[model samples]
Target: MNASFSSSSSSKGMMDHGDQPHVLAVDDNLIDRKIVEKLLKNSACKVTTAENGLRALEYLGLGDDQNNTSNVSGLKVNLIITDYCMPGMTGYELLKKIKESSVMKEVPVVIMSSENIPTRINKCLEEGAKMFMLKPIKQSDVKELRCQLMKYGS
Candidate 1:
């Protein structure tokens, strides 16, 4: 599936340079992606969406060309919120790939899953994911997410 991205400008008026957090949210499910987009928008973040891990890598400019490292200096994705279970590349794999990359490693990654398996959550955390969130993310979650973004910066 083709990767897609959307930026929320509704809260642009309320933000200064440091207020807007650029986020890359990945999910194969359209509804889930939209939910993330909406939630982040509500929190006044600049959000982008990707259909899967490979597409997300492409969005970050990390495709098949290993030599062409993801140049995120220009895009400045502060946080990556991705669904843990995807068709091709799971969120764990995506987190590993990002952590392995010199250009993208500094950008914090968060994994979201419907399953409440402790091992899965622990594994993601061990693999460098900042947080493992439960599926159907709520508005309350956005508050903590915003705090994380602030700590990480844009």
Candidate 2:
């Protein structure tokens, strides 16, 4: 795995820089989830996994409400990366749900898909996906995604 693909290291002798962004990686395939988790763990970033969109939503819902206020319950998901195709709830539908929710709407979402059909991509972008990456994932691609997220922080 590329070092750049790793999440920011906690022991790097730097400020906490706020809580390390927790990433939720949703996919039906176990191998796919493992690959993502391994890449994220290398960077020291906190990562959570869900086998489907519904499961992901359960975690997201644990956070505060969409109004941006702490929900008096728990922390919110900092980012979501979901496969575009799934058995129960598609990534598109999950994206829609995230957007509809007040607490989750602001979270950055990236759609990963083997087939980046123009219409699907456009719809996702239209619905508020920050970016999309084609399938057959690579560490370099993950590094680029980290860069994009850093931009938001700045």
Report each candidate's C-alpha RMSD, comma-separated, in the order given.
Answer: 2.6, 6.4
lDDT computed for candidate 1: 0.84
User: Candidate 2 lDDT, tens digit per residue, 8-78?
Assistant: 33456554536566678888887987787777656556667788887777666633344434422254456
Residue lDDT tens for model 1, 9-54: 5643534435578889999999999998999889987777888998
Error of 2 at 122 (Å): 1.1
Q: What would the TM-scores of all predictions be?
A: 0.88, 0.79
The TM-score that candidate 2 achieves is 0.79
lDDT of each: 0.84, 0.74
Stretches of candidate 2 off by over 4 Å are 1-19, 62-73
Q: Pick the candidate with the highest lDDT.
A: 1
